[model samples]
Target: MRIIAHRGASHAEPENTAAAFDAALVEGADGIELDLQLSRDGEVVVFHDATLARLGLRRARIRDHDWSDLAGLDVGRWFAGQATPHRMLRLTDVLAGWGGRTHLYLEIKHAEGRRGRDRHRELAERTAEAVRAAGLIDQVSILSFHEAALEAVHALVPTLALVRNVQRVGLLTRAAQQRAGLSALCVAVDRFGAAQRARLAALERPVYVYTCDTPAQFRRACDLDATAVISNGPAAARRWFAGQTSA
Candidate 1:
């Protein structure tokens, strides 16, 4: 099973920063996953949360601020004993820095509410452009929980790989997969069982489970023959897998 760094080895470094991404590569992750949202100026920024409060900054929606304003916030300070300070990273920064070196799982974060749905097309357009500019469209998979968001991306970049991210496996999830022409499915590790794994494998589409950090979970992913395992502790996962293989 492939080990994909969830938010760039987030357990070791602040999520969605350049440092974290670089660290994931150094730790031998097969790919890196990140979250994307639009800045006030229409730029694609790499961040997970809709607000900045989690990073110890004033509570503000990421979409409400310009990139310049977002960049000034010291995102690294929240993590204790961080070796170096990290700022927010742009989608371009990640693509340019580590695009071709490894696969990228880019999750398009939904906008704050109902009104944000209107910008899905523009988000898809911009994300497509960025991937094209990096010349890594083939190595990137666009992921979203919202079917409309994935549809928008497919319309913009038909050849790009798409994955339907679902918390649970069910009929609706299966329907979304067919409707979006998804290349793969990213399901929560706990919810994906042998039955679901067999079902997806039979369909010839890979199943990638997310947020797996413990050795037991990593082992389970391998035993289930998951296409990939997304984890916050890539280094630890790599170590465990290495031991398993060597043993």
Candidate 2:
């Protein structure tokens, strides 16, 4: 199975930063997985959380701030040996720099609260526009736990691959699959089981397992026939997989 760096080799570098992405590429990762959050100004920025508390700013949300306000914020201090501070990256920046270098699995998170549902369509539209502008439609796949967001993106670009981030095996329904024109299944290592495998097989979609950081998890992914394995430590995971194969 192909090894993808989850949040770009996040175990070593700050999650979602350019530094982490660069490290992942150097480690010979097959792809990079990242999260997308829309700034107030409609810029799709690379970040995993909606709030800034984990990164040091208290009681602040990414959607509440414009790109100008969010830029230059230190995003790396929380990570070990990241005292130098790394700023957030925009989707455009990643596309311009890393596009075609490796596959990108960009996850679009659902906005908070009930009213946030309306905003998901906006995020999808902007994300679709950015990807089309980048001209890397073949190299990227948009992933999301929210079906509405996935469907919204699909409506904009029919050919772009959309992968549903499966929360549980039971949620893998035919209607959801048909609506999003899903190309694959991204299942967490915990929730994957015989039922999920059967459903995905029935749908004839490829399986991509996430956060496989342990040797046991890597072995399990192979047994489950994962097309790709996403992890925080791509370099270590690659070594473990290679060791298992050679043995």
Most accurate candidate by TM-score: 2
- Extract clashing residue pairs from model 2: none
Runs in model 1 with CA error above 4 Å? 171-176
Error of 2 at 50 (Å): 0.8
Q: For model 2, how does the per-residue alpha-carbon lDDT over 144-190 read when each residue is reduced to its tens digit? A: 98888888889998888998887676776743455746888888887
**What's the lDDT for residue 244 in model 1?**
84
For model 2, state the Cα shift of residue 184 in Å: 0.4
Query: Residue 223 of candidate 1: its Cα lDDT?
Result: 56
Residue 239 of model 2 has an lDDT of 93
Model 1: weakest 10-residue lDDT segment is 171-180
Clashes in model 1: which pairs?
A: none
